[model samples]
Target chain A: MSDKKISKIKIGIINLKTNNLYSIYNAIKNIGYNVSIVETNTKYLNYDFLILPGVGSYAKGMKNITENNFNKRLIDFILPGEKKILGICLGMQLLFENSNEFKMTKGLGLIKGKVKKFKFIQKTIIPHIGWNSVVLNNKMNYFKSSLINKKFYFVHSYVCEPADINYCGTKTFYGNKYFCSSIIQKNIIGTQFHPEKSGKAGINLLKSLLK
Target chain B: MRFIRIIPKLDIKNGQLIKGINLEGLRVLGNPFEFAKNYYESGADEILYLDNVATLYGTNNLSKFVSKTVKNIFIPVTVGGGIRNIKDVEMMLSSGADRICINSSAIDDINIIKKTSRIYGSSTICSIIEVVKIKNKYLITKSNGRDIVNKDPLEWAKKLEQFGTGEIILTCVNHEGLRNGFDIPLINKISRNIKVPVIAHGGAGNFQQVLEVIKKTKISGVAIASLFHYGLVPKFKFKKNRIGNFNYLDRVKNLNIKHTNNLKKLKLFLKSNNINVR
Candidate 1:
C-alpha cells in the first residue's frame, strides 16, 4: 500500500484497562495511521481496524472486557468480517474458547483454541521471556515472507492451541515445545508476541499486516 | 530457538542519562531519549531506563521521559526506580513502559511483588536484585546500593521467582562500571536456581565480556551501560546545563576503552561466536 493509502487507515486500540496501550498507540501512530485509544465509551465501528492490546491475567482481562460491555461491541463490530481486529499477547489468548490460567476462564471464543500453561520442563523457564524467532507458516501467505524467522518480543507463560491446524499462522519454539505463535481466521488475527515492542522488524510486520 | 536479548540500560538522573562506576560516581551523559533512539535504530533488542535517584528521592519522574521516548522507539522498554506500589506500576505502564522493574520497593515489602505480579501478570513485573559481596558472602542491596539487605542473593532470587516475578535483573555492584567482566559464578548460580529468565547487568567493558557472560552463564539477556554509552559519547551533543557530574564526558575520549560502539557490531560478534542473538 502507498503511504497515502496507509495514512488513511483508521485504527482503534481497545483499552481493556489491563494493557499498556500507549506503546501500541505510539507504534500505530508512528506508522502514520490515524490511531486512537478506544476506551469503554469509544465507538467500536468508527475505525477500519481494531487492535486488542492487553497485559495481565486471563481472568482479569475477561472481567474488564465483559464488565465494560466490550465483548458484545467487539463481536458486533466484526460480525460482517469486513473490518479486521488484531489481538496481542494476553489479548490474543482472550480470542480462544477458554484458558486454564489460574482457573478456568471463558474467553471471547472468536476463534477455536484453548489456552494452557507451559508444562514444567528441565532447562526451560516459565513465563518464556525474551525475543524468539517466529517461523511463519509457508502454506498461509497472510504474513510477508520477510517475517519468516524474524524474532519478536515475547513474555508469557501460557500457550494457545487452536483446534484446527489451518488457523495457525506461525509457530515458535520455546523449551522443547513448538506452539502456535500467531493465528489467522478470516478477519480475526492474534499474535503471541508484542509486535509493538519487537523493534524495527515488528514495526514492519505491523505495517504489512495492518496496512 | 530462543534468541538472547541484548538490552541497552540507560541510567537517568535529573532527566539526563548518567553512568557510574560500581553504582557510584555518577557522570552525566546526553539526553536519554537520544541515546534510546540511537540504540533502537542500531538494532538494540530492548531499552531499559533506570532512574538513578528515584529510590533515594522517593519519586518516579521517568513516566514523562518514558512516554516521550516510546513515541519514537518501538522496542520493549523496561522502566525501573521508585516503583513503590501498584499505582506507580500503573503509571509507568500507562506511560508506555512495557515492564516495570522494582528493587527498593520489593525489598521494603515482599508482598508488593506478589500483588503486582498477580494483578499485572508475572511477565510484566521484573525484580532487580543488586548484589554486593562482603566477607565472602553475597548480599542484596536496595536504594541503588545505598542500603544493604541481610539476605543471600541466591535466596532472594529464588524468593523473587516464587513470588511470580516475570524476570530478574541481577546487577553485580562490585563488578558494575568497572567493565572488567561479569561475575560468572554468581550469575550462573542464580540463573541455575531460578526458573525465570535472568538478565545479567554490570561489568560489561567490551563485546568479549558480554560474550563471556552469555556463554558462561545461562542468562537470557545482557544489560550493558558503560560499554554502549561510552562508545557513543562522541555521537551525542550535550547541552550546557548543570545536572550531574559532566567531567567524565570530557575525559571519555582519553579513556581508551576497547568496545564496540554499535549494537549491530556486538550482535554480529556474538553471532560469529555461534551465539543466538537478535
Candidate 2:
C-alpha cells in the first residue's frame, strides 16, 4: 500500500563563479528542495538533481571544466540511473559537442550538435539580451500548463541545439531561434535563463522541475 | 550564451549625467536618472557614473552621487569617483549600488582591493586604472590624470589581480580623447593576468577597434565612450584562433550610421558571411 515514489528530492549545485547555477540554486532552495553545493575537485555528485550555471567565454569555461577533470566526473554522474541535470546559459552550451565562443572548444556530448553564435535576421542584437517567450513544439510535464508563451530572461551570445531534434522540447528566440532550449532527452532537462532573475515564469518552471 | 554590455558613461559634476566630445568637453545632457531609465529600457547592462567634482574639491568621496544613480536605475548601477575609504565603500553599497568603481585610490593602495573585495564579494568593486605614457613609460594618474603616480600600468594591474578584485575596467588615457581604438596590448595584458573579466574603456572609435579588442585580448566585455556616445556602429572582420574564432580588425574610421531592427536579416548575414560591415 506504500508507494516510495513520493520521496524527498535532493539537489546539488556546482560551486563555481559563473552565476550559471545561481538563479536555479535560489529557485530550488526557495521551493524547498534539499540542496548542497560541491566543487569539481570534491566528489559530491550523488544527488537526485544536479545544476550547472554558466557565464563568460565558452572556450575558457570548457577548459576550466576539463583541466580540473570536472567534465569526466559529470558524465560519470549522469549516465547511470534516473538523474536530472540542468545547465544554464553556458552550462546549456556545454551539453553540446563543441562551442564557437572564442574557438571550437569541446563540450560534453550528452547532447548532439555544436553551439553557434546568434546571427540576427533583422538587426536583432547578437547576444539576444532581455526577455523573450518560448513556444512549445509539444508539451512536457516540466512546463507549467498555464505558463505557455510566458516570457523569460535570456542573456547569452550563443544558443544550444540538441544533436537530434527529438531532444528539443521548446524553442525560444533572439535573431534565429533553433535547437534545444528546454530539452527533455529522457532524464535530463535544462533551461537557458536564471530562475532567480527571471521573475514568475522561471519560478513556475522551477516549481515544475521540483514537483 | 554571450551577454554584451552597452554602457553609457555619465560624467557626473555633482551628481548628474554629463556628455561631451572630449574629456574636457562637458555639458549637462539630462537628469542622470532619466537617461539611465531610457538606456536600461533600450538594453544597457549598467551605468558608470563618474564624478567630475573630486578635482574641484580636495575630497573624492562620491557617496551622495552613488545614492542618486542607484535610486534612478532599477537595475544594477556602478558609481566611480572619490571613493577613498572603507566608510565610503560601505555607504555606496548600502545606498544601493550594484558595484563601486575605484580609480585614483586603486593605484595608491592595491590592498584596499583585497579589503573591499573580501567585504563585498569581489563583484561589487571594480579597480579602474587611467593610464597615460610619459616618455616611453606609461604613468598611472589620479584626479583624472592630473596627479601622475610612479607605477607601470601593467605591473600594477597584475598586482591588483593578486589583490583579488572581481574585474578590472582599464581606460587608455592616451586614447581617451583620440578615439583611435582601445589599447589592445594593455587589454591583453590585464585580461591575461586577471582571473576576473576585464572591460576595455575609453577609445573604441569604430567597429574595427571593437573586433581588435576581442581578437587581440580575451576580454569579457568592452566599454564604449566615443563610439556608442557618437552613435556609430562597429563593422567587424572575423579571424580564426587556436582558442576560438573571433572578430578581428585593424584600422578604425568614424562614420555616420543608423540603428536598424532586423534580427532575421542580421542572423542571415552573419551566417552567410564572416564580416559584419556597417
For all predictions in the order shown, the interface RMSD in Å is 0.9, 9.8
CA shift of B206, model 2, Å: 2.6
As a whole number from 0 to 100, the lDDT of residue B202 in candidate 1 is 83
Best by TM-score: 1
Which window of 10 residues has the lowest lDDT sum in candidate 1 chain A?
A137-146
Off by over 4 Å in 1: A1-5, B252-262
Error of 1 at B225 (Å): 0.7
What value does DockQ give for candidate 1? 0.86
How would you encode candidate 2's per-residue C-alpha lDDT over A51-140 as one tens digit per residue?
A: 876654576567667767888888888887488888767777778898776467788888888888666564343334445567786756
Candidate 1: docking tier: high
Best by DockQ: 1
